[model samples]
Target: MVFRVDMITLMFGLKRYHHLLILLGFIIATVMATEAMIIAAFPGIEEEFGVSSVIIAWILPAVMLVGAVLLLAIGSLGDILGKRRIVLACLIVYGAGVALAGYAPDMPTLLISRTLQGLGLAIAPLAYALVAEETPVEWVATSIGVLAATYGAGSFIGIMSGAFIIEQIGWRACFLVMVPVVLLLIVFAWHIIPDHGIRKKGKIDLIGMMLFAISILSGMIAITWIGLAGISDPLVWICIGVSICSLFLFLRHENQTEDPLLDLGMIHEAPFPEITINAFLVVFSFFILLQVMPYLIASPAGLALSVIYVGILLMPGSLTDMISGPLAGFMVSRKGVVIPFILGALFLLFGCGIYFLFPMTPVLVVCIWMIFSAGMSILLTIDNMIVVASAPPGSTATASAFLHTIQSIGGALGPIVAGAALTLYAPEEAFTVIFLVVLGVSAIILFQSAGIRRHLP
Candidate 1:
């Protein structure tokens, strides 16, 4: 009887939960590809639509606005609703959005379709939460690492494949490519992603969702308009003011509510706050590099390579991400988290230093960037692990969403700050500013490395 029960448990657990990593990988890769392809195809899209660069930029801004506002709300809903149901719904919505985007006849239609895509994109964090709950403790880091690397993988694929498709077919073909990919991935996800047996049954906090969404919407729109349009615009100023006021109210609402969307107390954990701050600054600093290398490679300042060759340079950074993510996970699982976190920060600092000192040498720069990218990947991969581990049971999704939402905000701000630096100084000088900030943040992390290790699993 004992042997039979053990066998039954093995069969059910193995069949149900073993491939959580793989499913999350597929989700991350698909979502990243979707976002990256849209960004890569922007030039072609602008030309096709007969719009200015600024107008084309609005496409992504619109998508991001929706995502920034709604991700936490959607994630909380995932807790109330079944995560699998939300994942399925999001996949269908994403696929339909891709199809609509592919056939968009004008800018308005494209904007609408992209907004739909953003709503779907908000599900990415929910997927992360699902993986956190379902994956075994032994391999959680590796699992999250793969999910982290998927974004880099997607960016690499999008930059390379989107350019090829635009060259061979047209910009519209890029959107069409995702439709099939989404449909296929969704089918696999439905098959493999096991249902976590615990379910929360309750009414979602509608008031919290509305206030949070409004706050995020106003903030994101203000930021977007300031970055792409002029900050002096009356609309931008109004949005900024409204965002501030709304966010204050939103926080107050969440704080007073019996069941908050995000319980504010979780962030008070030692590692959680430190890691969150580190992730924000590191992402903010490195994301500038995303544009920097591409700009240098495209412009006269650097190699002036074709989009194809530039894509190759991006590969090292992404390939490093692919390797570092899993390896960081393993390190955290075995050696503990602090060493990897410190090392990741050091690599980012090194990358910035190299870029500042050797701005003219493309090959050297790429090599330095690989170091930075690998380190950044490690930090990100481990940070997720840290966040999940730090949180109390069942708050994994909310914690993950909170961290990622901040990282997204950092990513949004990075280019704007870097772009401004570039306008004022040489590329090297701008990189100096970026890297100094990164190094300063890393130093802070290093100082508290011992404290962080104390808190980790």
Candidate 2:
């Protein structure tokens, strides 16, 4: 009777969380759907504003910068206030930003509005925290896997359908249509997401937030300016200088503050550094696409595939990513972190290897990339679960945000590192060099598996 009762309680508790997982998935999917549409519509937006591609290119970086800036504060805020509060606020702001961008009269307005939507990135950290706080520990990985799967499925749908939406309905409609979806999410989140973790007495680390935001913003701007103004540009140097100083101050302040934005001591520990760095490398490695794919498929040093064919080629990757996400998460629950993470790294390396080993055809390129995408999903899912597991008491959201912020920094460096290869080598050579560098990064992640094994459950 006792054993039966325990089983019943466990099953009943987990069943509710299944609904929570679904809710979180839909929330993340909505955010991703909007994000992918913007990427697909970049050309149309550039043409609409009559701006040079160079000027309009800032749109993507602008969103990334805002996400990095807000993540620290949002994470901390969610911890002190409530995850539900923060999640709903992010949805509302993101929806407004998207809606405003649809009718933005000028380039500046559109840019600002688009950047505002980056607040939606807050939902990611909150999502992990919510599951960690609510779901059973043994089941957390499976739940995270579901989230990762949805992320893959969402991005694929968004990119695939987004391309069509941008073409038939116009770029404006892409942003405009998403407003209703966001509104629906806001409703779902309010009613469905349980509110718990509220620490009204906790202080907001305003100064720390400012310094961190400045550092991330300035540093990313430096990288962005390097592409725009050249390596020797004074603007780039100035931005770099500001970023360093802000970071020093931010670190110093955090060490002294009672309620710091990020508890450095908690994260500066073992496994966290190794895992977060690996996450960075994972993103930095994957941005090979940002550097190579467009040029490889459509440009002069190219397979010269049509747009439709390129889309078809990428279609399978989405499925692989969706599958790999849940698979990795499940592996972590069953097999522990080391094996799954190392496997992910191996998959990434193998993906890179195929490009060098085989002749580069459109079909081969697409098929090989699926392996890399799957690896990416696995590594990221494991990485997030680690953060979720390692979260400081009462600061789950803050910890998850910190990890993501690190990943975001890596994301910022990805394009710069990949683009540097292009400048130094011919297009084909550059692409090859970039993949080799990515392989090197993946190799390091695999190497760390041995050291990190003792740290995981």
Candidate 3:
């Protein structure tokens, strides 16, 4: 009896970390569904609200802008409050947003609900931090990589399922779907996720938060307005000016503060900052296709693949992402960071070459794109591990959040840039241009990897 009890306890000790992972998967799935549903719901909402397609575009990016602006601060807050607690609060915020979105009676109300949904986006980096802190060192890389890949998985499932749901049920049903998922995640998270540690004690930086929020909001709005509404609009220029000034003030404040929302010193560290910048470039470069391709396929120029076909093409990317993520974790565990990062960069370059060679042919391009996505998956997964590993003991969430924020900002910018280029040039030409630019960035990443030897921490 004593032996059996001891064996049971030992087995549970090993399995305990998995509870956090389960929570992570659930959280990722819910947030992804929320994001996809908002996009899928847009056409329905636009029809009901009588808004233009251009106007509908605002619904998603606006939320992203809010997420990007708040991610670092929220992560820092998590560090100060406790990852599980902050995540619970975020879940409530997310659930409330979904409920509101479901019942929204007007365009303004729907927009507000969507904005609230964005609050939940911060959960992702927090999840990474939690896994990093809780999982054993042997499993850390693999677990974190898998957690990272869950986002892609969630995205795949959500978008594919969301379209079908929207068609069969109704637009409002899209938001309604989240209520159940969020409830489940909240319950699991409450039961499973361990308390990481106390957040640093301090008063929340309300002013800093305001300044940062204003800057990002203004900046994103300007970018979107310039692309959709025209750069000549007076409102665009006003936003631009406000964004620049607010950004300057925000940075200055960050520098002066004792308990700064983000310790910018992390940016100066080698490999962390460089790798994060690479993450931004990757998001800026590859994520553009995420937006453009779907539109193009649905339009006259593409193979006019149905949502199902598009989902199929996306499958390999997510699969490669899923496989590569753990592979990266394993590689990083045995071999150091440089080799994995270098291989990923080389793969990206090769993938870009493939894209440049075969842009027009949809079928062949999807295969090549998978190669590209595989490379990105390797890089992103490892890069996130690097971010968490590089941070000071307590600041993992903040560091991950900053890195994620950069990626989000890039995701926000990609569509606008790609869309504009497509508008001005031919699709083939636009693809070539995008690939060439990505190729250049990939080369830079390769060159930067050579310096990784200098910064192993």
Using TM-score, give the best candidate's number: 2
TM-score of each: 0.84, 0.89, 0.87
Could you tell me the C-alpha RMSD of candidate 3 in Å? Answer: 3.9
Model 1: weakest 10-residue lDDT segment is 1-10
lDDT: which candidate is best? Answer: 2
For each candidate, the alpha-carbon lDDT, in order, equals: 0.69, 0.76, 0.73
- Candidate 3 — which pairs collide? 79-199, 80-199, 80-200
Model 1 lDDT tens row, 97-174 = 889988999999998988788766677677678777776766667778778887778766876776667667877788
Better of 1 and 2 by lDDT: 2
> Model 2, range 208-288, lDDT digits (tens) per residue?
889988898787677666655686999989999999999999999999999888788888876688888888888777764
State the local distance difference test value for candidate 1.
0.69
TM-score, prediction 2: 0.89
Taking the tens digit of each residue's C-alpha lDDT, what string does model 3 give over 254-288?
88988777677887786677877878877776765
- Pairs that collide in candidate 1 are none
